[model samples]
Each structure stands twice: as structure tokens, then as C-alpha cells.
Target: MKDMVELSRRELIKIITILNLGTTLEWYDFIIASTAAAIVWPQVFFPSSNPASALLLSFTVFALGFVARPVGSILFGHFGDKLGRKTSLIWTLLTMALGSLGVGLTPSYIQIGILAPILLTIFRLLQGLGIGGEWGGAATMATEFVSNKRYRGFWVSWIQQGLQFGVILANIVFYALLGLMPRLEFFEFGWRIAFYVAFVIAVIAAIIRYKIAETPLFTKLSSEGQVLRVPFIEMMRRDWKRVLIMTGIFLQASAGFYIAISFSEAYIAKFLGFSDSFAVQTVILGAIATIFGTMLASFLSDLIGSRRKIMIISPVGVILFSIPFFLLLNSKDPVLVTLAVIGYYFIELFGWSVMPTFYAEWMPTQYRYTATAFAINLATPLSGGLAPIIMASILQTFRGNYLIAWPYLALVSIAYGIISAISVALARSDTAAKKIE
Candidate 1:
């Protein structure tokens, strides 16, 4: 395999662009469902339930995708590690496109009765499986292409930025649709247009991915015959503790992000008495902040010379601002709500921006694909997948007092901060142990 130093600037740029496009498509499709779950899916699929119950049910089905993500991680991780990154990524993209197409064409309960939600759930599961594998592959491909180790964080952050861009794009489309169409028409057909658009983007991304070569690190490992026959099993037996640490590290960021982006829209519209358009606009502002925050955090990580310190400190800030975040939202002003969301995401960027580079460096190149996918997918169900439902339940239990949800959010952030601190200590001890040996 060629070293990163051997690759030309053009080749590096090409690789990053291709991989970022794939992640952007994946997140675009996923965010469509998330946006719909909060704004439209309940009306279409769960009309029989009360508004809160219907939204909860929609989010529950949304979580089903996260439930299937670990399986996807293992399935694609196997081929990604043994076969190749490009090959596995192509397949993941195709799978996600299929799910997006299915979702776009699915009829509402009013049209097809109970079968509507069943199909929606099935397609959501397919999407979960695809995205479960997409992140690890994209992150690996981007970071491994970097010639200078110092800039790995900056390069890999493009993948995270792709996700934020998808959120921005999704909200822009929704915002435009809401502005153009009447409420009934927007609810009935406008949302499905976003899914169709996502499917088309996914296909284009898959074609781009297919043309790219495998990463140099994976090629090097494969050529050396260092690849494991059963990478997942090996990861489980040899590096399970690392997997646990990764899961812990991601929990709060994942949950906090979904709550801030997905659940906040519904909370604002339904609980806070804001318009749906205002809620969508708020997310767009937040996503814009997230993109800037990711780039800034990545640049700072390189300058600071420690990803772990940034990750640990970011969550502490989130904990400190949790109450204030809710208070800003409670102001019920669109501008304040937008500012609150942007502030929250800026803090979130600290951990998230460094994750791709951190995970790539933490795992062995031989089974990095499988291990990273498995750990992240496992954490998703616990955090991002359940975030909406958890928040909804909290709102319901507390009788729509948005402020009451702050403690839960704060507790999660504190736990993430503690876990990150412990992980850093464990990593230092492991390094010392290796030196002693």
C-alpha cells in the first residue's frame, strides 16, 4: 500500500470529497425520517393515538432503525475489514437508497391502514442497517488518507461536517416546502418529496464511492495478511473494553445531539407553542452553528495536541449550560430559541468533531472498521435512537414543562464527562503498560 506521504494533494482531496459525499447522503436520508417523525409522521402513520402518543410512537419506530444499526455494523464491518472499505461502503449506500425509496413511496395509514406503519418500520430498519456501517467506513477512509498525522482531525472532521450539512439541507427543504404549501398539503405529500430527493442523492453518492480506491491503511494491512478472518469476534475478545469506552464516550453527545436537533423541533412546536416553520428554521440555524463549531473544534484539536482533553471539557460545558439552554428556549422567541440551539451545538462540536480522528487512531487498522462500527452502533440505540422518545416521555410525564427535562439532559452530560475522563486515564495507563512491556 502507498503511504499517505506518497499520495498527491489531488488524490487526498478526491478521497475526502467522495467519502464526505457518501456520509452527507446517508445523514440526509436519516434526517428526513427524524424531521418527519417530529413534524409529519405522527399525523400520517399514527393518527389514532393522541398527539403526544402519536409522536412518541413515530419516534419509537424511528428508534427501530438504531436498534438494527449494530447488526448492520457487524454485517458490513465483516466485509469492510475482510473485503475492503470501498466495497462495503458501496453496498451500504445502495441499502440506504433502497430504504429511502421505500419510505418515499410508502402510503399513509389513512390510505393503507395498519400496513403503512409496518412498512415504514421495515424501511427505517433497513436505513438503520445501512447508516450503522456508513460512518466507520467514511471516517476510516478520510483519516487514513492523511499524510500529516497532525491534520488528521481537520480532515476527518469533514465527515462530521457532512452530517451537519445534511441537517442544514434537510431543514432548508422542509422550510421551503412549509413556506410554499398549505399545512394539509405539506403534511400529505411535501414531506415525501424530501425522501425521494434523498434517494436520488444516495444513488449519486454510491456511484462516486464506487469509483474511489480503497484506503492505503486497509490495503497495507491486507497485503501484509494481517487482516482477521473474523474481525468482529476478534474485536470482541481482544478489545471489548475499548468498545465499552467508545460507547461511553459517545452516549451523551449522541443523545444530546438528537434531543437538540430532532426532539427540540417537536418540543418547540407542540409544547412551546411555536410554529412548525419556526422550529424548522431553528434547526437550520443550529446546524449552521454545528458546521462552524466542528471546523473550529477540529482546528483547535490539532493546535492543542490532545483530542481527549477537548472531548472531556466539551461535555462539562454542556452540563453547565443545560439549564440555561432550556431557559432560552422557554423564552418562546424564535430568535432566542435559535440562539439556544446554536449554543448547544457549539458545545456538542467539541466531542463530535474529534470523534472520527479519535476512533481511527484508537482502533487497530486491521479491524478498525468492524470495531468502530460496532461500538458506535451499540451506543446509538442507547443515545440518539431513544432521545426523542425519552424526551417525549419526559414532557408527557412532567405535563409539558420543557424546563423539567433539563435535569435529565444535564445528568447525561455529567455521566458522559465522567466516562470521558476515565477513558483518558485508562488510555494513559495502557500506553504506560505498553512502554513497560
Candidate 2:
């Protein structure tokens, strides 16, 4: 598994930096929007007589971003495979920049009536489109740049690690704002600052990406005239099963991760009556723990020489913890709630570090970006995008019965984890040390 082009230490470092920055910006923008939906947008853009209705509408808009992701994936994934990763990445970053900037500048409902929500939805969709293709390009670039097949999971994982940093960074910003301003002020104007920060991150990431070269594997494909005209169609015709399996393998994380980080914030602060600062603080702690957990898992995946084994085993943790996680959250005890949040985020996603490398290795050079992005994005809207709305609906449906509601919620997560485990186990392949197909 020799590298097509060997990178010097400095060049490799720069490549990794740009990849991580692009992904970090992607998730940072996503997290801030989630946070805003939970605490800000319902009040600002979707004002209503009934608070719950307003919150649900805001969550719907947030989910719209996830809905637009697959479309983004298809659009940019096409260019990524046919043209170059660098070009696709630059556009994705700028698209996200425009989205975040629009969100930051858009007027509130009081100022602009229905147009506020309409503009907000448009911006959110743009954010989704940008992120839909961002992870695939970043992950593919990282995979192609490095040569050592043995620890490729560990290296590409740095791009995924941006998710943890994004969570931490977003929560920290929100925590600081909540601490400094009154709750009323935060709802009024403080939330806009977070989206502005996202705009800045996109600008920086786009500049770095524009300066970098395309991945060596893609360059080689281009030079040899092997690039596919329609990578998505080619992938579906030949590797559809693999795509489906990969989508299933991602379901556990797709559902549980968003439930814990994005939905739980609203659940904790709005429903459970925790303070905004407390909710943000808990997320920051959980995100910090996840950084270490995922890094350890990456190291283990490489050490074991089987990403599939790690993938198959990790979902069991999610299945086992699903019930307990909700039980802990329902306790209304700060200590228990904090522990539950941390464990929910950490345990279910222990195998996440292997995803980028695993997905990339399964596809041929020409189809890698389109296949990987399509698979992940398909799973995203199915579970990750709708998770908050679903979880909230369950809670509202069984309004007075905490016991029944919590377990019902847990059942949904358990189902996803079980599906993920079975999917990975069914995919009988060992590509850990093999060259990319």
C-alpha cells in the first residue's frame, strides 16, 4: 500500500491541518445551529403562543439542514470524483460560510414577520448542503495522503476528531455567552454571535483548502483518465450492497450521537428545567470525554488490525446503554444527568474513528467520495436529522408518564444500535490492511 506521492512531514502536517479545519468548521456550524434551535430560534424566528409548538417548528427547520445534506453530497460528490477533492472542498466551505452569515444577519420574527423563518430555513438548508459533502472530501483526502495502511484509521480519524472539537468549541462559546449575559439578552442577540463565529471558521478553512493540492489518488486517477463520469451511478450499480451496509453501520452513531448532543440539550434545559449554563457545561464535558474515547478507539482499531471487528463490537455498547442513559437523564439529578450524557456520547461512538478509513477503503478510487458521502448522508436524514423531532414527540405524547416515555425513547436507540451491529456483522470483508479497491 505505497503512497502514490510521498509527502514531506511539513506538507503532510499542512494537509492534515486543512482537512481537520474544514471538518471542524463543518461540525462547528452544525452544532451552533442545533444549539440555536434548542434555545434561540424557537423564540426568535418561530415565535408562538405555545412554547412547545414553537420549539418543534424550530427543530423542523434544523432537520431541514440534514434533509439537504444528501442533495449536497450528490452535487459536490460528483465534482469531487470527476474533478478534484480540493475544488469540491473549497466550494463546500464557502457554501457553509454563506449559510452561517445569512443566519447571523437574518432578522427576527418581530422585525420581519414570516419572512424571518423562511430566510432561516433557506440558510439552514445551505449549511446542510455544504456539510453533506464536506466530510467525504476531507476523509477521502486524508485516506489518500497517507501510505501506512496499518495506522491509516488513526490518521484519517483526526478528521473525524474535528467533531469532538466542534462540540466542545460550540458549547464553550454558548456557555460563555450564557454566563456573561442575561437569559433575555442571550435569546435576543447573543445567539447570533455563535453563527458569526461559524462564518469566520468557514472563511479560514476555505482559505487553507484553496491553497492545498488535490489528493494524490484522485490526481493519479485524473492523470490516467480513470475518473468516472458518474461516480454515484457507477457506485450504485456495482457497490449498492456495500453502500447499504455502510449506511446501516452508521445508523447507531447517526441516531445516538445527535440524540445525546443536539436533542438532549433541548430536553435537558427546556423540559427537565436545567439551567442553560448547566446544559452547555454538560455537553462540553461530554465532548471532551468523546475526544479521548474516539482517539483510543482509533488506536485500538489499528492495533487489532480489523476495523470491522471494532465496528461490530461498538454498537453493542449503545444497545446496552440506551435504557440506562434515559433513566439517568430522567432522574433529575445533576450528577446522574452529567454521567449519562457523557457515557451516551462516549460509548456509542467508540468505533467512529474507523468510519472514514473503512468507507474509503471499501470503494474504488473513482467512486470513493460519492459512495462514502452518499452512504453516510442517507443514514443521516433517516435517523440523525429526525432524531430530535422524534425524541421530542415521544416525550410530548406521553407527557405525564416519565417512566413509559423514557423507555420508549430508549427502545428507538436500541433498535438503531442493533441494526448497526447486524449490518457490520453481515458485511464479511477485511480491508483493513488491503489496498483501496
Best by TM-score: 2
Writing each residue's lDDT as its tens digit, candidate 2 over 164-240 gives 88888888999999999988888888889998988987898788789887776788789899988888899999999
Clashes of each: 0, 0
Once fitted onto the true fold, the runs of candidate 2 whose alpha carbons sit more than 4 angstroms away are: 1-5, 400-403
* lDDT per residue (tens digit) for residues 1-437 in model 1: 56777888787878888888888888888988898999899899999446778888989999999999999999999999999999999999999999999999999999999999999999999999999899987887776677255566887899888889888888888899999999999888988999999888898888878988887778888888888999998998998998888887787778777877788888788778989999988888888877877888888887767777667666677767777887788888878888988888778656788887777777887788888888889988988887677777776677666567657755654565565556545554221001100
Question: How much lDDT does each candidate structure score?
Answer: 0.82, 0.85
Pairs of colliding residues, candidate 2: none
Alpha-carbon deviation at 385 in model 1, angstroms: 1.3
Error of 1 at 149 (Å): 3.8
